[model samples]
Target: MIVSRGTVAFMFEGSQSEVLTEFLVSARSLSEYRAMFALSPRDLAGRDILDCPGGAASFTAEANRVGARAVAVDPIYATSPNVLAEQALVETERAVAWAHHHAERYRWDFYGTLDAQARVRRAAATRFAADVRVAPERYYFGALPSLPFADNSFDLALSSHLLFSYADRLDATFHVKALLELSRVARQVRAYPLLDYLGNPLDELVDRVRKELSTNGITTSLVRVDYEFHHGAHTMLVADRSN
Candidate 1:
């Protein structure tokens, strides 16, 4: 599913798969559960944010708490017949409704109560009648590369565990292209990565980002979030377009 406003587009993987189960559950209380993305303030209140690779609408949910106009983008908005476990359009809509209704639970009310949260999730699922079919949000289905938006359109954009996990070619060139696309649409960018999974040092990753953003006429700053999962920490890069 590709979600966009004008020139910005976000590509997300679905949430039905177990690959992102832990992250999605943790995202309910993104600050407390996954506090490692140290990028200035924890909350995105009043900011315009782009959430790419939007898993279970996790970050988007948080962005909504702070009154941020958030767009959740992903390729797997509905699902592919081949990927049986991925989130379908119905699932995504259900999650979004739950997030909207239980904003407090996902924000400050969440206290690692797996059972309670699960119960709420289940209830929300029923209320939304997601078991049948999900109602399409205006932004649910869209095309890619053509972001349907103009340049330098967003105030802030974030991509968590997107680069390393979603890229087909894990080479430097691939990363550079991905960064370029991200920088093209946002005034500021922050990305979360499981760096160790890439076998790349944090400093090296920072340097690469700096160089890439610099070439793209964007200045970059890297901040580290202190989270529990060793690899859960993120190399949060704040980028401002020089153009």
Candidate 2:
């Protein structure tokens, strides 16, 4: 999420236990969640939200408090909260170090400086950890390209950074399939900063995603957002499937 795309950050530890295979970073703090998802209190009112790849963001914690039905699905939730908390702290430190070393690679228009970025991430993680202590069920252990939910399960589904950020690693077929899965469970899906991890646009993949969705009776569009930490990466793809 540091490449001017969105705030979905993850560290790859390769496959483990022959079962644990990938890490999907969704640790963007609450404020970062707002910027990355263009979310507001109004946007979540009385809606069921699915945060796919929900690493450790405070969006679900915050949203659930306000009467919104929010659920965070990620592979990390399968582990013990204590373990996830420890791993999250390590990753946060690593991310902060990266931002400090490669400040120029980020836009800083929203977060301002490396110090603020660290603070936000730390705070978000803290909020997330606390919530886990009280309500662990809010965080579900799961992965994408496939979701375990009934059709029309949620009203808003938020997937940031991952799908397009790893376009090269995840081929066009994976992108289309993942979007379709998200579309299946949620009425509306919003994915931001439609660019690859290198701050480069995934033009072919983007077009293909929209085209593939359209063929399935879904409509997609790139909507301009208020937040843009990466230069030239200022839009989010909003897709709506017919009921």
Candidate 3:
């Protein structure tokens, strides 16, 4: 396993299909996993979207279901905490069961919960193509950053746990830089700043996100999700396209 910023990225040498099959089997329930898709703005139909820090592609599947071309970019491949097989199994199990639980909400056509899980696993195995050489902030285009991307390459970009997890450990400026970089790459961005991890107020963070977008001459709308099932307050900022 290779490590980066205290996270592990693993690589798998066998066929991805075999690895994905086992992942589907362990995905028994949709508990914590439901939160990922539950918060996505359903209005984004027909829009090209990007799920940055896309863990197991839960958001990626949402975008795909909505008829949008979606891409998932994360550094998990570069920093494997364990073997790729283990990570794939764990993440796939979490993600598929979540999807299966909300099959009705997503209007999915699976015959049963088991079928839904199987479908997601098959889809991931069939479509999971990621090149570790590409930089993630570059909109599905290059190696993990330290390298940035061109401006306005994406319609929507989202991260579930990116900046918030780095607060006390990293310099304040570094956190700001990553957020700014994410805003730079995306025309519209939605981010769930993990509350338990960063302890930053959701309102304050949305204001900061708004200010960051404003600094770049873009208008932004920030919606804070506050619901019981999604107990954690997450910030969803949508930047208006200037063109």
Best of the candidates, TM-score: 2
Model 3 spans with C-alpha error above 4 angstroms:
1-42, 79-85, 90-149, 194-213, 218-221, 226-235, 238-243
Residue by residue across 11-95, what tens digits does model 2's lDDT show?
3343522111233344586566677778888877898999887777777888887778899887677878877776666666655
The candidate scoring highest on lDDT is 2
When summed lDDT is taken over every stretch of 10 residues in candidate 3, the lowest stretch is 20-29
- Candidates' lDDT values, in order? 0.47, 0.75, 0.45
Q: Please give, for residues 48-166, the per-residue lDDT of candidate 3 as tens digits.
A: 66666554444454445556666665545454423433555555545455444434333232223457556656444333323212223322322223323577666777655455543
Model 3, residue 62: what's the lDDT? 44
TM-score against truth, every candidate = 0.58, 0.87, 0.53
* Candidate 1 residue spans exceeding 4 A from truth: 1-36, 39-43, 78-146, 165-168, 194-206, 231-234
Q: Tens digits of per-residue lDDT for model 1 on 151-187?
A: 7767776666555543332455656666667678777
lDDT of 2 at 90: 65
Error of 1 at 219 (Å): 1.1
Candidate 1 worst ten-residue window by lDDT: 18-27
Model 3 clash count equals 12
